[model samples]
Structures are given as structure tokens and as C-alpha cells.
Target chain A: MKKDEVPQDDANVLEGKLKTLKYATNEDGSYVQVQTVGWEPENLALSQAWEDIHERLEIIAQDIAAGKSSPILYFMEKCLMEPPMLAKHMGIGTWRVKRHFKAKGFAKLSQKRLEKYAYVFEVPVEHLTQFDPTRTS
Target chain B: MTNKFNHRQSAHCENGVVSNLLYHEGIDLSEPMIFGIGSGLFFSYIPFVKLNGNPGTSFRIYPGYIYKRATNRLGIKTKMRTFRNAEKAMDALDANLEKGIPTGVQTSVYYLPYLPSQYRFHFNAHNIVIYGKDGEEYLVSDPVMDDVTRIKRSDLMRARYAKGVLAPSGKMYYPINVAKDFDLKPAIIRGIQHTAKDMLTIPVPMFGIKGIYKLAKDVRKWPEKVGERKAGLHLGNLVRMQEEIGTGGGGFRFIYAAFLKEAAVIMDMPELNEIADGFTKVGDRWREFAIMASKIFKQRTNVQGDYQLAADIIVDCADQEKVLFTKLRNLKFPA
Candidate 1:
């Protein structure tokens, strides 16, 4: 907070349209009120990580479209889980989970199996099974 | 009935909301003051509770504790309610807004349109104030934002009903009444004492000072037990918990230090200033741990991170906090 000690009336004005914190300052470059404690470093890093997560999601969506990977991968990433974690949650083996990650294997999933995944992901069964990967929302 | 409420940006959500509401009530209090009086600080590491496949590690008390405790200390009688149905919750908020009462509501952070997409997650327990409505959009005063932002009813509803751990459940709260006086000395004393006991006296090893030590020990084993990639994820998550999200860094140690500094001035307890400085150093140590972990996360190092060394750093933090809280617990405040 030594930054706060710079005798000022306001924090510097933020530049970007993004809602991240910025300092407000006077025209003469005097100190003013702080918009927030700057999170530039941490948030910058988080943004990169989030981009990576979304990148995986986009690839999974492509796989689903190409009938390669199943929509299960999409739900898994949405729920912030990996195969091993979901396998543990579903009381199944990781190999089974990995198999289910394929479109052909997922299409043959039992109602009971699909229901278990829906339960763990906290999504409706229909939403899980009939989801449109292209739908951004 | 909508009043033009002053919107001030703050470091954290709940504390900002509390400060804004109090200011509207004609009581100007700093965010740290509200936090300290409300006893907003706490620690709990529940390995059984999982968030994104990692053990749930929280630096502060559950959401709404600060608003509840801080308001009560100020003799403010507030009404808070949660609903099973989203319609009723929206109806109640509309009613309060119609009555010119800016109400506080909890929502998930993911759906707030004003925030950067990267920062948005499924995490619930974000607090904001609804000050007005224009046709379909509600005027929102999200504390972390630089100005008042507008959100459509549908988006806001989705935010309120967001599912997952610690779901908001369409919860809203507002102060129904405010008293003329609140005796601060006792509240400050009580809050400090409560924090001390929780940090030092709690028998559970996964909470307070013990929790810090336990995390230090458990974290070292993550690489062995979960593999390098997943272990790396856990460490990164720990950093997020400490630095990103709602924490103002070092799990809010610096914020608490600022609180102590203000408390010292208000109560004429200059010694509290010394303790506050110590806490700042503690926060710095936390930052140090974070910097070290960041290197591991970025895979910048040639060899695997020295988990033992990192664990030692946290143990040192815990040790410093233990001694500091002990002194704070034993300190006699003037009656």
C-alpha cells in the first residue's frame, strides 16, 4: 500500500474498456483516489489461463462436430473436471471415462451412465446429452 | 423511488457493498473498518470440500458474514432472506427498490457482463447493490467496478440462480433500520479476540494457524500424490485463492493490517500500529510464496520446484501469525 501513500486526491483513470482496476489522477499528475488495488499481474495471468481453458473447450467442440470426441469433454471442462476426477465421481474406472470421451462410445452410453454424469456436472440430463457445442452461451 | 447512490470502487465485493450502504445511511466508514468490525477475516481449509477438483481453501469467513457482523456492530437491523424460487427473490428485490431501499444481493460472478471474460468463473457469493431499474435493465453498483453498470433482467436472474457450490439461491439483504449510536471499542476488542481464538485455539488442524501449517505439509505431497500436472494445478489454485479473486493479496492480511492501523488511530492505541506493520510484513511473506509458486506454474525453472522450500515459507508465515495473534489476544484494551 506504499502506493496509496502518494499524496493524492484520486487514482489514475483507467484506459481500457475492460472493467479492471486503474488509478485516477489529476491533470497535473498529482495523486488522487484509487480505483482499486491493481490486479494487473494476477489477472493478466488468470486471463491467460482462462484463455487456455477456453481453447481446450473450443477444440473439444470441434472434435464433437467432427464426430471425434464426445460432448462429454465439453461438459467435463465446463464442470472443471478431468477424466480421472469424473471417473472417481461416477464410481467408474478412468479407462471407461476415457472411452466415454469418444463420440461413438458416448452415443452408446446407458441412461444410467448419462444420468450419473449429469448429476456430477449439475446439469440436466437432456442438456448433457443433447447439448449443442456451438452454442456459446 | 430510486436514489442516486454514490458508487465507489473497492478492492473486494462484500466490503465495498457494506461501505456503500453505510455511506448511504450517512455513516462514512472505511472498507477496512467495516471488515474489522464485521470480523470478516478467517481461514478454513476443507480438503473434503472440493472446488474445481481441488480442496476448498478459504481465506475469509463465508460470504455475508462481514455485512452481517459489521451492520450488527453498528446497531443496524437488517433483513436478509433466501428463496427456493427465483421469481419471488426478484419480486422482493423489486419491492425494496421501489421503496427507495438499495438492496444487497448475492450472485455468481460468471454472469456479470461488465467483468472481463477471463476473470469470470462459476464461483458464487459475489455481492452487489441494485439501485434502480429502467424498463428491462437493473442499475447495479458492483463494488469492484469503477462506475455503476447496467444489466438486463434476464442476465441478472441467471446470475442470481447460478448453480454449484455456495449457490446464492436468490438471496438478498437490506438494512431495515439504523440506530443513532454504535459503541466501537467493544466490537473491535471482540473481533480481535474472536480472530485470535479461531487462529490459535481451534483444535482442528485444518483451520486457523494450524491450517496454514497443515497446508504447508499437504502441499508438498501434491506432486507425489496427484502427479506433476495436477499438483501444479493445485499450487496455481492456491495462488488464485491468495492473490486473485476477492482477496486483496496475502489472503487479506494487508487489508486487516490497514484495519488495525485505522483502529489504532480511532482507539488511541498506538501499539496496534506496530502490530499492523507486522501484519504487513506477513502479507509480504505471502506475496513471496506466491512469486515462488508463480515461477513453478509458468514452468520457468529448469528443475521441479523445491516443494519443501515452498512449504517452509508457509510454515514461517504461520509462525509469524501465531505470535502476532497471541500478542493481540493478550493485549488489554482500555475499558
Candidate 2:
């Protein structure tokens, strides 16, 4: 794929988040190197993939609101985790995790269970329960 | 800031850091060249080895292998050290930066605030260069990023000490001396031969071209074996391995093709360009596989096609790669 090349005006220009490349030429007897930076097609594709994941998260958040899904599902997708992995991280059984996947069951979870889940998701227990997309997402 | 370190970003992090470091040492090489020389291309699907509760699928070799192998092959003596303490690690990094030497450090992407929030995972093998210190933040030339990024000392320390399978362990590396007259042909030949041999000669069913076929077979049975939701997540991680961190676009086939394009010119063999084009087609096939996977994964619907179809596409990719690598291994160059 052809990469987008942009000039490097030091490191502070792009808030340190863009992709760039520098090229060197053996065209003549002297080797001349020119610095440039820009986005490649792959970059766009990657960003698109991330955006798609966010869109899914948005839908998942809505599902949580509409009682169609549990907030656990949203956290799982957001953290790119699976039930089995989450179970392992929480040091609990997969069946227990399946139960926690329900909103009602999640609400009745023990404080210890909530703490385990909160630590695994790297969020506070309150935020884990009262998940606001604006605050966390 | 000292302009001695000419940072250039590339498609992949490890190889990009290798290229940039080599350039700073006055031995200019492209990321593809470094990648090819390191024999960085690989494929593995180990169902027994679980990561994130799914089968671990890998598109390339381990993270630092490319830099290590490429530098070693070029007869470059590099200083690589791992610190037991974060403070010592920072001291070592500062010591090197004080001498105007850019240091390449292994870090976790999860703690890197500059990365897109979604792309940050618990992966601890990300590579970046610290060229200078600008106050509380360090000047980091992350190869996967477009420009130099700044990070607080605490964040950098956290990233260096991030916990995972392949933990960084506060490791940092820099070339102490690079050979002034390193030859190209032998290194290129070795790299090409090594890749072709590994891909075509590996007897294990879980590795190389056979691994791709095995993954296809497993993908077909994913839903039945693991149920619907797990199957979707498994396939998603499989593609995430391919697309994220420079694997998704035809599994870096295009990048290798670019290497071949440069190699043809470096070796004065125009025919390699034609071979490069052939590999590009193979890469295109890999992209097609990713697209099919995304369609099934994102839509969460089995209406258009099933995992069986995606697996078949990958089997085809394996077959095509077999032919490409075979030709690459057998091609003759003037001595």
C-alpha cells in the first residue's frame, strides 16, 4: 500500500499520535535522506477498525439501557475480552461468569465479586456498576 | 533537541525501530529490508495456548526477534540490558540519552497514552525509542506511530513494567558498533532461504503454511466447538492478530513485497520486482480473507457466509503462499 508522507516539523506537531516515515535515496553518488511523515492506507484501515469497534460499543451501551443485554457484555467488548478470560481474570468459574452476564444477577453479586470484576476491568466498583459511557467510554 | 536521531515511522514497530536505529548508526536500511533480513514472517495457531481465553494465533514471530536477528546478521554489536528496578531503568535510559545515543525500549501498549484508546491492549512487546528528554516527558519515537510522541515519566515507567506473557522487564537496547562494510547479498539470501525453509519445511501441523490450513479447519468448527458468542470472539481475535499491529493487510505480505522491490534494485535484479508483484497478489488474498472475517464478525450474522467459507479462503492463502515462498527460495542471483 502507498503510505502518506508528511514533513516532520519536530515531534510536537501531531500531538504525538500520527504515523510518519523518512526516506533515503541512493540515486546519485551522494546519499541524501529526507524526512517525512503521514498516514498510510493501513493507518486508515486500522482507524476504521477501531471506529467499527466503538460503534459496536455504542450499540452495546444501548442494549444495556434497553434491558436487552447486561453491562458485562459492554465491558467485555470494550476491553477486548471473552467470558472465559474474564472468568480467569476474576478467579471465578465460567458458570459464575455466565450468571454475572445478566443484569439482575450482576446487581446481586457480592461485594467481593464486584471488587474482583472492578479490578479486572481496571475501574472502580461504583463506575463498574453505574457505567456511564461518557465517563468511561 | 539533538537532530542526531532521524526517526522514521513504519508499518510495524519492531522492524521500524530496527531500521531507524540502523540509520542513526549510519547504516541505512528500510523497514522491509530489516524485516526480511530478520526473517520476521511467520504464522502459528496453537489451540492449546490460550490468550485472552481464545486460541493464540500469531502472524509474526516474537516481538524482539527481528531487531535481535537483523542486528546480529549485520555484525552490529548492540548493548541490551534489562533492569530489575524501574528507577535504574530510567537512569540507564537517561545515561544513554545524555550521550546523544537513542535507546530502544520494549514497552506495553496498554500504558501508552498516545496510542488510540481502542488499540491499547495488555500487549507488552511494543518497541519505541527515547531520543531526548524534554522536561517531565520523554521524546519517544514509536515506530508504529507517525511522529515522535511525548509521555510522562510515570507513564513510561508503567509501560516498561506492564505485566504480561512477554513482559518488557524494563529492557532497553542500542547499537554499540555497526560494521562499516556489511554486505547485502548473503544476508538477503540467508533471510529468504530461512523463511522459505521454515514455511515449507516445518513438519508440525500447527505452524507455517500448514498452520494456516489448520486454522481454517478449526475456524470451520469454531461455532460448534465453542458456541456462537465464543466463536465470534475467537474469529475476532484471529483477525485482530492479523489487522492490528501490522498483520491484517495480507499478513504483511505487501510489506515483504516492498522489501523484495527494494532488494531487486539493491541486488541489480529486476526480476525480483515481478516476484514482488506475485506476492502482492497473495497479500490481496489475505486482505480478502480479513474482509470476509470482518463481515461475519461485525455483522454477527451467519447469513452471507459461515466460518467454513472464511477458513477456505485462508486455506487458499496458504496454498498460494506455498508457491510464492517456493519460487523465492529457488530463484538464483548472480554471485
Candidate 3:
């Protein structure tokens, strides 16, 4: 791509706060580094991916509200994590992590266990326990 | 006990880290040179591996291979360590800084507070250099950033220990010995040859130029094999990996082209210059593919025929790369 041809498409996800570096061909056919705000195709791909994540999270949030699931699922989806991944982060068995996804199993958790989960999620234990579904996306 | 580290930005992280560290040691090598000599250019599409519920795609070699291979070919000795205990890892890093060593640390992008919120994800294997320390903060030289930045000790710790796939686990490395004088000709040849062989001769359909063809075939089947939304998500993931951050566009193809240009001058091979231009065209095709795939991903077009069109573009890319790498593999080098 030519230096002048580097895409400067407005990526609202970047919020106009940052510019990324790119390599473009100069007149001599040699490469020079150029800063780009964003490219249209890349921005579209990114938004679509994020949209998929949000859609999944919205479904999980509804489940939590209906008492079919726990807040753990909500936070897990928010963080782009699966049960196996969350289990690895929490240093627990995979089956145990799955159990925690349910409301009944989550209610029986001890304080120490809750603290461990909170630490991995980087949230306070109280926030996990008293999460408001409407406040989150 | 801080080392006199000079920070310079580059198009990619590992390449930037390798080039900056070598420059700090009084051996100046541009990021393109480091990337080329390191055999960093690669491609792989693993359908079995899932990321974000989509098949994984990689545009470069495995993490840390660039540093390992590039330095090895240059005959530089380096020390690397990874720790299971976070406290011990932090202590080891502090000790290295105490000895005036600017250490390369692998971290998770998600925990780096200096980055924009949108860029923060569960991505591990991001590399940065720590040159000095203040009371509770450490000076960071992230190759992707335009300027040097700082991170709190606590934040750095979290980044190092962030869990999930390819977790850093507090990995740190630094060059211990670099030869005062060395020749670049042989290393450049070895790097080029290594890349050609890998791209052309890899037997697996999921790797090398073959991987591109496989992905092209898969792209056509995606909407049929899976539903539209899932297939679109898969294509979106492919675009994310292709135009990955810090690659300077067209995956890593542009950097490889720059490397070839530099190598042509140093090795006095005019033929290599022509080859470099060909590869640049291939890179352009890759970008073209991204553009089409992104449209399909966003469902911007009403026609379902877009899938076959996108697949054709990918096939064109694969065919171009096949010709380039075959010519590259057959090229002769001066002893």
C-alpha cells in the first residue's frame, strides 16, 4: 500500500483517541512507517466480533435474571472466558467450575471460594454476590 | 542500576523487542532485519483449536521463536526463565534490573492498564522490556507503543500472571553475550531459505501455503457447514488475525518485503529486489481478501455469492505465495 493510500477510516471503537502504526510503500517502492487511525475492514470485523460477544452476554444475563444461571456466567461471558479457561485461571477442576455456573451451586459457596473467584474476575466479592443485571450490558 | 536502554518503536512486538535489545547492546539491526533473519513469517489455520468459539488462525510463527531463532543465527547467547511462583518471578525480575539488565518480559495484554479498553483482551504472549524501576512503578518499552510508558508494580505482576492459553507465567529473557563483530550475509541467506522451505514444503494441509488453500476451501463451506452467524464470526476472527495489531498491515507480509529489500542491498542481489515486489503484491491481495471477508462478516452485502468471491481471493493469494516461495526456495546464495 502507498503511504498516501494507508486507510484512515474512522473506527469509532478507537474513539479517535489512538493511532496505530503501519508500513506503506514510498515512491521509491521502499517501505516507510505510517500511523493510521484505523482501517474500515478491520474496524468492521472488530465490531462484529464484539457484537457476537455482547449477544452471548445478553442471553446469559437474561438467564441469570430468570434464576436459571448465576452471576458467574455473566462475568465469565463478559471476560470472554469459557468454563475450562476460567477453571484454569481459578486453579480449580473443570467440573467444579461448571457447577459454579448454576445458581444453586453458586449459593452454597464458602467465603474463601468466593474470594478466589472474585480475585480472578478482578471484582469485589460483594459485587459478585450482589450483581445488578440491569446495570450491565 | 538501570541500564542505558534506548527505546524505539517498530511495527510488531517481538521484532521490536529483539531489534531494540540488540541496538541497546551496540549491535544495530532494524526491526525488518530482525524479523527476516528470525524466520518470523508464517501462516497456520488450525480448525481443531478454538478461540472465541472460532477456529484459530495464526499469521506468524510461534511466540518467542523470532527471538530464539534470530539470535541463534546471529550467535548471540541469551538467558530465559519462567516461574510458577509470582513472588519469585517478581524477585527474579528485580534482581535482573539490579544488575542493569533490560529484561524482556512476556505479558497478557488484558492486564496492561496503559492500553485502550478496546485493545484489552485475554491475549497472552505480548512482549515488553523493563529498563528501570521507581518506587512502585516500572518503565516499560512496549514495541507497539509510540513512546515509553510506565506501569505500577501490581499491574505488571497481574499482566505477567494472567491465565488462559499461552499464559506468560512471568517469563523473562535478556541477552547475556553478543559478539562484537559478525557478518549478516550468511544469516540473511539462512533466514530466507528457512522461510521458503517452511512455506513451500510443510506437509500438513493446515500449515504453510497449503494452509491458505485449505482456509480458502473452508471459507466457501462455512455458511453451508455452519449457520450464517457462526460462519460470519469465524470470518471475523480470520480478519482479526490477518490485520492483527502492530503488523503494519497485510499480516506480516509487508515486513517480510521490507526485509527482502534490505537483504538485497546488503547481499548485492538485484534479483531479490524483484522478488520483494512480487511478495508486496501478494500482501496487497491478502488485504483485498480481508476487505471482502469483512463485508461478508458484517453482512453488508445482500448476495450469498459473496462467500465464493471471498474464497476466490484467498485462492489467488495462495497461488501467488506458492510461486514466490518456490522461486525463493530455488535461488542460489554466494558462499
Indicate which candidate wins on DockQ. Answer: 3
TM-score of every model?
0.82, 0.77, 0.97
RMSD to native, candidate 2: 6.4
Q: DockQ numbers for every candidate?
A: 0.17, 0.15, 0.69
Over B1-335, each residue of candidate 1 has an lDDT whose tens digit, in order, gives: 44689997776799999999888888788777777888887888888877766788988888878998788777889999999888988998898888889888999887787776556677778999999888888999998787888999988887887665677989998887977577777878877887888888889998899999889988888777877666666777778888764565677887788788778878899888888877877877887787677666667342445777778889999999998999899999998
Model 1 chain A: lowest-lDDT 10 consecutive positions: A6-15
Q: Which residue pairs does candidate 3 place in steric collision? A: none
Candidate 3, residue B124: Cα displacement in angstroms equals 0.7
Q: Quote the positional error of residue B315 for candidate 3 in Å.
A: 0.4
lDDT of 3 by residue, B1-335 (tens): 54568988887899999999898899999989999999999999999899878998888999999999999999999999999878999999999899888999999998988877777878899999999898889989999887888999999999998888998989999999999688899999999999999998989999999999999999889888887888888888888888868777898899899999999999999888998888789889999999988888776443568999999999998899999999889999887
Considering summed lDDT, which 10 consecutive residues are worst modelled in model 2 chain B? B241-250
Q: Who wins the lDDT comparison? A: 3
All candidates in order of DockQ, best leading: 3, 1, 2
Tens digits of lDDT, candidate 2, B1-335? 44356877687889989999889888888888998999998888899998766799888887888988888888889999999888999999988988899999999888898986656767879999999998788998988775777899999997897654777889999999888899988888788788888888889999889999899999988878887666777776776677555541457776677778778888888777777777767776776776677666666665424787888889888988888888887888787
Kindly report which residue stretches of model 1 are placed more than 4 angstroms away from their true locations once superposed. A4-69, A72-76, A79-137, B300-305
